[model samples]
Target chain A: MKELTILSGKGGAGKTSVAASIASVAQNAVLCDDDVDAADLHLIFKPEVKEVHRFEGGQVAVIDEEKCTNCGICWSYCRFDAIHTKAGSGFYINAYQCEGCRLCERVCPSKAIHSYRNNNNYWFVSDSRFGPFVHAKMGAGEDNSGKLVATVRQKAREIATETNAEFIINDGPPGIGCPAISSISGVDAVLLVVEPTRSGLHDAQRLVSLTNSFNVPVYGFINKYDINLQVSETIEAFLNKNHIPLLGRWNFDVNIVKAMLEKMSVVEFAPEGETAREVKKVWEQLKSLMLTD
Target chain B: MKTLITSTTSTPEGPFDKRFGRAAWFCVLDEKTGESTFIKNENAEGQSGIGTKTAEKVVELGVGKVISGDFGPKAKKLLDKFGVQMVIINEDLKVIDIINRIKG
Candidate 1:
């Protein structure tokens, strides 16, 4: 199955909206939300969870106060001030502060600090109106988002293969960070939803380079293109220079937000509207390109 | 006692940097001798895990206290585990003024 990841270098570039709309148009597609951090694709898909799995991301050191001999060895050895000592209480580990390095656990003369995997993170397989969806929620201050993204993508791929789905629509996270890298790696193609602003163009250029490094074919579309026509033109020029096809330029439309409020794709919300037509056109162009390859 | 303060510049006269992991410089102040030295944060431009690296640096320096506008979750955990005093100063004060405040 062909996998298409919709990525944006900056957040609020309508990546989820575009991906949701494309999913509504594409047939035989398994949708996956790879944006574990601040995941919002669920806001539109309204997935009914089918399966839930715990994500044991990383280890966090825990201190047993009862086993105390407060020699301060663990305190001095720990680099992450995760261990705190109260006047009455000996020492305690701050779950939020801990990176789970386990240095304190090892160095403790009293052996009071024990490290354990934090199983707070969770991923889900759910059914949405579009199709089978794979998504995850990373616990607050949770590490290893890249791993969580990979996990969901793997499940989505497995489901796609078993069901003979033709495509996998991945709603990727913002920025060129680890999660973005995980989402782009080995994807069949990338669709960058760019905004018409100076930072938008700059960040999209970075994302383009990142995708290029992974040897992934990328296409671009300017979201809210009319907001800054000059910047949109510059973005188009950059995409052209990089040999990336500009699929569609969508005008600034308030209906997109209205559609989101109703938890529906613009195409579903307004089937015959201009915005929906533009989204459908973009999907058609993307499908044609995918078929040619 | 050794105290580390995140700074925007390498000099003590520079403003205090709010970010801990991405701070440009770390001003190490000697409380006993009243002398200060600046260490450039090599992990400032790192792609990831700079908080842990910065915390390791603070530990390696044997700093007893850290003064910054804010510390990341990882850094705060490391510093707390090591019993390092963390002082949060939200005001936009110069490095010198912070140093004086600590001295006082």
Candidate 2:
């Protein structure tokens, strides 16, 4: 099955809205939300969770005060200042600050530092109106978002292959960070939903370069293109100059927000509106490209 | 004891920089000897984990205290683990002034 990931180099560029609309339009597809850090597609898909799995991220060090000989060796050797001493409490490890590198655990003369994996992160497989959906929720200050994104994508691919789904629709995270890299890696195609602003163009440029480095085929669409016609034109020119396909330019619409408030895709909310019509056209173009490739 | 102060420029007269990991310069001051040295932060423009790198550098320099406007989670954690004291100053003072305040 062909895997299509929708991404935005910068947040609030309407990436989720576009992904949700595509999910509504596509038939026989498995949906995956790879933006584990701030997943909001569930706000629209409202997936009824079918399976839940714990994500054990990296280790975090905990100091045992009772075994204490406060020789200050752990403090001297710890690369991260995660261990601190309170007046009454000897020494403690700050869970929030610890990277779990285990360096302190190795150097502790009293053997007071204990390391353990954090089980706070989790991912889920669920049934949505669109299709089988895979997503994850990251714990506050949790690391390994890229790993979580990879896990959900793998699960979605398995479901897609088993069910013989035609496509895998992924809603990717913002920026060219680790999670974003994990989302686009080895995907069939990338659809970049960019805004028409200076920073939008700048970030999209960076994202396009990143995708190019991965040797992935990328297409561009300017969400709310009419907001800044000049920047939109510039973005279009940039895409053209980079030899990337310009799929569609969607106009700014208040109805899109109204649709989101009702937890509905724009196409589902207003089938006859220009926003819905443009979205459908983009999906159609994307399908043809996927099939041709 | 050595105190590390984040600064915008290499000179002590330069304004203190609030950002710990991405600060342009780090001023290392010897509290007892009253000598100061400035080192350009090589990880200032790093894309990721610059906080951890800066914290490691601080430890390598044997700094007892860190003065900055703010520290990222990783830097704060690493510093805390190494028994380094973190001091947050909201005022826009020069590096020299902060050192003077620490001295007093």
Choose the strongest candidate by DockQ. 1
- lDDT score at residue A246, model 2, on the 0-100 scale: 92
Model 2 residue A240 CA deviation (Å) reads 1.4
For model 1, the local distance difference test gives 0.84
Per-residue alpha-carbon lDDT of candidate 2 for residues B1-104, written as tens digits (9 for 90 to 100): 99999987899998787557667799999999989999999876543566788899999989999988656556777998999998876555789999899889
In model 1, what lDDT does residue A121 have? 88
Clashes per candidate, residues 3 or more apart or on different chains: 12, 10
**Model 1 regions more than 4 Å off:** B1-104
lDDT of 1 by residue, A1-293 (tens): 67889999778888888999999999999999988778899999999999999987777888887887877788787788877897785778888888877889888888888988788889999999999999998888876455567678878977987899989999998778666766765566789999998999999989887776554579998999999999999999999999999888789888899999999999999989999998889888888777666
| DockQ for every prediction shown | 0.02, 0.01
Compared with the true structure, all predictions reach lDDT values of 0.84, 0.85
DockQ, prediction 1: 0.02
Query: Which lDDT tens digits does candidate 2 get at residues A71-172?
Result: 788878776788888887577788888877799889887888889988998899999999999998878888645556767887897798689999999999
Model 2 per-residue lDDT at A141: 88
